[model samples]
Target: MFWKSQRKYMIFLIKNKSEGEENLINGKMNVAIIGVGYWGKKIATEYSYLSKKDAQINLYAVCDVFDENLEFCKEKLEIPHQTKSLKEIFENDEIDAVHICTPSETHYEICKEALEHGKHVTVEKPMTLNSLEAIKLVDLAYQKKLVLSVGHIFRFDAAIEKAKSLLEQGWFGDVYWMKFTWTALMPPMVGRDIITDLAPHPFDILNFLTNDWPNKVTCVAKAHRKGQQEETAHITCEFPNNLLAHIEVSWLNPERKREVQIMGSERFTKIDCVTQKITGYENEKFFDMPNVRSNTIGDELSYFVNCVRQQTSNQVSVNKNNGLVGANVVKLLELTKKSMINQRTEPVQ
Candidate 1:
């Protein structure tokens, strides 16, 4: 049955390719933003800018359940199509791809539907709630020959990219440990927890810098305002070569900070994720590393559109924010939860 479905999907892709070639030739790809709420609005804004700057992309439509969100798209974004139905977006052959900014829990279902409808997808982080569902989506995209990208937006950050380059060059020699501090003063989200909501960025950033995943994880989390879900948490990840990473995420902290610190034998480097600033301390000397900031969301959207235009298959592994990377981060989140519950270190299996 899987093989049969895969064959039919391939045929569908072939037909779609032929029919869509004219648009491709004209360097035009119609894209949609699903769920233009808080985060989705930001995504929509970037796409709106991209549409005006690049003729290749069209901010074709937006889908949201709320009337106000749709209204925002209509008035603010000037999107051509605005609807409250996913069915309408999926059935529309003009929309070449979808950027899903819906809540994390809804990702798997919507992403699956988009792929089944022969649309490329770029779903936000925590691609799904679990690794199993993430892997299934990965496989589906592979079978359909579609671009399946995750919103690991930090990977597109100039500072993060520069840090990766420096680490690759062994500028931070004999790395000792790393720390990620992501804290904000925000009220508890009803159904969301700190680990799933905030930890994805740190874990994904760790993978981005080290080009590896943690072998073991130990996590401690608690809820202060509400007992339903954790509001504050600390996760310790054990990577290969004795590299340790500590991630601190909290909704209780008054100050907002998004920083990554790396301690190495050569220098201690700190990256201000928001400001795109990198500072290093070496031999009692503090120096600022020059880095030009980038609009991460815009770059990420452009990369996804390029992938769609190239018909980049998940099998080719051209995308940095590919499905497998998202799945790995989800697996880490699951393991972190396990460690928190068991009060013991859990191995990443």
Candidate 2:
């Protein structure tokens, strides 16, 4: 049943590969969100809400295969334009960018089409189901000179950002290891398991904290649910500088939890992403660190808009959520999957 997921697979040609500043005209960027499902609705709402205040950005359109989703967007979001055909979004000359929030498997083609049409794109996590497709999207974006960012929202969190700053400042001197736990009890997301569904968040955080990708991975997983996918998974990533990262994810837990523990030579830290709290352990004492709350999803979307705006004006160095980080995340995940299948450590390619 999970394999027979909703949403039809989209196929598009790689036409109009010409690259220029298509995202910005008269200092405004018009964006369309494809797929108004759970995550897509959130994105659309953010964009629509922001569009009212930000004159430089416009939430131009919304698209989804499900009519119910479209109707909901129309009623609640009051979005100016809505469609079931992604082709309309692509074919529209006014839209300067597109957000691909469909299933993981559909990311490659939709993003490829958006870039091919000279529109910037932001695809949700696990950019693609596999690395090959991930690489293709990355390369296509680079070739087209369009911003193709992946939605790794936690990277914009204030707590994680502060924790990363502390780590970089050597507060966590000579970091030896880190542990991430993301587990909860909820209805299983169709076409997703703990590994593919939940692992990307922490894995991307691991990369963000260290600014490095894991060189190797090993995993053990079990499928407790009716799907072929694992409902619980334990994955370990070996990074350089003797850094080891462990990720534990499951849908079998009784309560919801999101926690990260990092152990270093000088001090250690425990972060609760949900509560926006951090506790530092050092010198036989634990103290809570003050954290400023910020809307991560809003920040990420704003950053994406800024990147598109800058890149359109030929300002190339502006850093936004790029595709390479997302690709690396996909590569590491594929490696872990291989390790699970082989029951041994697998080198990340």
Candidate 3:
């Protein structure tokens, strides 16, 4: 019921905000984007844009353990303040929020410390290794009255957002099984596997849309990618009301593909995330849903900061909406971990 009610509330809220076509995020927040790596750089760039053009936030500093990463961000963005320690942020009373773009393993420790110090935190996907850890972190943030946000970037996707709109308006009929595939080829195990790393976006977004967790999950994986970890997995999730979702993740494909096909009773919706486009198919009827595309990268960071500085309505709701997304991610990660461990020692034929 939490998901159902929140969807209605979200619909009402966004409709009101869109009427004026004015900026939804209006306040300036003092913020720092930690872990200056891949997505971390995106966070910094968004913050930098807000600082330079939009004035939606003040990019306080960039923090990272690797001196090279710190220097890279500092020189590339012309940012002056750089630190290897998170202590500087807590010591200063001025900073209000911290964006953590670190690895999955570090999310718990970093987010916990930040929240303990009363700073709002936005940790990247795969919120934690498991649900118990996620439950604890979210609970702590709530106890501290701090906003804990997860970087499930696709939740902010224009197409997915529109899908939510359509779903609310009863655009799609009784939902049927949906399929989501995300695949890419990379230099051998340069990093993590596909299921643990790549699958979170789709998994999180599915829960975000349906407002329900998978009652059961099963996964099958392979070790074709030359790593101890299984780089590809075919997984399925069963939710209430006969809603099923199939997720496939692989790092062994040639051309990378990221797409979702949400089948409903009346029609089917195929979304191409990379292209940011949604195509709909119905018997004797085929049409396209135009992009409600906003500057997700800019708007998302601004949204998190604006919520903190304004002290009003925000997107990341603990135990309300965003928490479930994190919980679902943890559940999926557990299955992935099990698959990885079993595959690593499967007696060779």
Candidate 4:
């Protein structure tokens, strides 16, 4: 129902655009979204909604392994094409792009196949289960001259973007260190742990804000439920210029939290990713930072559409959520997992 309402709002925008913003977008681009699970549905809805606003872009198809999901997309969102086979979507020449919202384990093969079929690809983070596969997908996207984006949503968050801009303006002078917390209580998911499931968001956000990658990682984790995956973990990363980042993730916390704090010699900033709010503190004074609040998922999809429309690798969009950046995040996660196993700090290889 919420997505349906969003679609209506988009239709209103489209009606308004016809009068004034009709020339905003240059060319038409067709996109398909594979996997209609929880996250996939959101991506598809945004694409469907935005298609109304940008006449050039269309939500060409939606794919899922389950029959019911396809039915829902067709009936609920009025998507033109709904399929149970990925090959069907891949075979459609009209689809210029695809968003991969499937499981982490399936990301590599799906993204590679999409790129091979001459489609720009956007896979949900972390890009792949490991760095090597991610590198391969990145290389394939480069070889085909297609845009490869990873769904690092926090990069599109208003608060995070604002904080990044402030840091670039040197508002927080001589940055020292930062901390990230993402915790919640939830049922265990097969083949998922705190590091792989929840850590990616904060990891990518830190990389986005710092404009640097971590060189070293130390991780400590525990599986409290005896036979299940690790439910809690702490990871410490060392970045260039002696900057440090600490992340804590858990599925056992009583109170949910998604926050990042960056401390510097001059001042400090606190960001709430969920609220899209940021506050700066200096000299015992706290001030709320102004930011333009926008639906990050919608913004991310729009960026992908623009990239697809641009076509050429030279003119392709580049940001912290690109394949290369996603690959780096995977590399760091791999190192963090290694550290957890060896009980020692590991250099990011």
Candidate 5:
């Protein structure tokens, strides 16, 4: 039944692409959004807005299994093309790239298929549930000569960029340790736990600021809810130069907080991730740091589009949230789970 519907959809897309070949000749990149749910809708909106300003980009199509989502894209977003079949999107030679905002479990297969069809892909984080799957996607994208990016949106945050600059300039001299607090009170997701769902941001942020991966990790986690998957977790990571980092993620906390603090011999710096605000303390005095906040999702989508264009033109493109970075974060997630299971620190492989 599924294959029959997909075959019809593919034929429809082929006919449409034939009529639209002239548009592609102008070097305009046609992009699609798959899975227009909560987060995917936001990504689509950013692309829509970007397309209005950039003549090189076209917010060409959207795909979702739900009829209401497709309707929303057509009626609300004004996207021209809508389909429920992944095959149709992959087979459409007019689509140069796709933004995948589907569930984490589906990332591996969707990404693999997209790459196999010669389409550039940028997928939401935790690229895949397993490290091996993530690695395979990375290798496949490289072999296909396609741009594969992950939605590590926080790396584009204004506050985070400022923090990285300050650290690079030795503003926080001789950094000691860093702490990340990401907590909220929310109902448990169907098949997701705190580590996989929430820990990637902090882990990736740690790497963004320090430019280093953790050497060892120790984790303690528990489930206070109905499922066996942990809802709260505390991860301790050891990085180079004896730098220690801690990440606390929970779904049980009443107060929602997304924060990061860095302690050093010269000063203490704290970032409010949600507000994009930064504060610093030195000698018992506190001061505000300059932060010009920007929409991170907008920045991220723009960067991905630029990368796609560069790749299409055979130019060297620098992708900060590349596939390898996503794979490493997935590996850390696996090691974190392993540490929790063994009740011991595990060396990062």
Candidate 6:
């Protein structure tokens, strides 16, 4: 029994594990959401819906530059307050955290400003546009003692969650090779490259699914479509323990696809993170793994909000990277571009 439990009677009946008794009502935590665009709307909607199940959280505010979007969210959630400027949000001292789902280019500035406000922060993936800014944000969050979480939404997928648990349990034999494919008729770059906008999800998922940091990176890129940054590309990265991995990301596909295949000596696991389904093959037998029921995006946001309430446990395992992830992303892009440049000079093999 605990005071934190919804039943107030439990506080009086409960005994502390060591001290015998204590009561505390640390109460609800408030969350402020910035951005009301596609991704932001999804996260805010989930946070609002989850709050119904979780009484300890209040989705206190929503902010966006667009008045119509703000109004839509307010009407959708029945919340009375929505603001256009983030100044209105950060001005509220009661707000304890922020989630950013704006454009990739804006990630660094928004996240930096939120951190300086002493608010715990969660921003959509890629960390930032480049490694330098990403490093600064990671370092600053630690300095402020505010929880910093990157919305690596797939990290909350039950398939990867189960994979991590299986790895710990040694269910899969010695691991070997992993292949991931992410194909979509990706949005035109317009102002930013597809590489910058799309690669982070697959990159982060590969890392999460493998539970390893890359040691070396090499890549090949192709730009078949005009005015697009590498409409098709292949990235290969090496991890220690002789584990090899390959990733293919393309905007050229006529159909959307998201898949990961992990190969072990005894078992091979294939998952479609996009569809939230997984299949495994072992000993010449094909089997479907149990359902992966995580509302991953929702779960990720809720987890961040919950950690804000807990106030002690960390949210992201690799929270402080000094922009190593961004650096690696740059390394991959550079290597792929180098390959493309060299391809023009070399004769057919």
Tens digits of per-residue lDDT, candidate 4, 230-259, equal 999999999768899999999999878899
lDDT of 2 at 229: 78
lDDT of 2 by residue, 1-349 (tens): 0001101101121243345443444577898999889999899889987898898888888989988999988899888899988789999989988999998889888888888888889999979888778877866776566788999999888899999999889899899999999999877667787777889899889878887777778999998867787888999888767899999999989868788899999999999998879999999999999999878888999999878767744444355457877877787777778899999998764
Clashing pairs in 4: none
* Each prediction's whole-model lDDT (CA): 0.87, 0.82, 0.72, 0.82, 0.87, 0.68
Off by more than 4 A, model 1: 1-26, 312-317
Q: What TM-score, over all chains together, does every model reach? A: 0.92, 0.91, 0.84, 0.90, 0.91, 0.82
Residue-by-residue lDDT tens digits, candidate 5, 211-241: 8788899999999989898999999999758
Cα lDDT of model 3 by residue, 1-349, tens digit: 1223435534654464421111122355678877999889988887888889756568888889899888887888877689988899766667778888988888888888887777777888888876778867755654555677777777777887888777777777988887889988777775576677888887777777876667656678777756577778887777757888898888888778888888888888988887778998888677887786767777677667655554433333333225445755776667556645554321111
The TM-score, computed over Cα atoms with residue i paired to residue i, of candidate 5 is: 0.91
lDDT for position 139 in model 6? 58
Q: List the residue pairs that clash in candidate 2.
A: none
Task: Give lDDT for model 5.
Answer: 0.87
- Which one wins by lDDT: 4 or 5? 5
The list of candidate 6 runs beyond 4 A from truth reads 1-26, 312-349
**In candidate 4, what residue range of length 10 has the lowest lDDT sum?**
17-26
lDDT score, candidate 2, position 254: 81
How close to the true structure is residue 241 of candidate 5, measured as C-alpha lDDT? 86
How far residue 263's Cα lies from its native spot in candidate 1, in Å, is 0.7
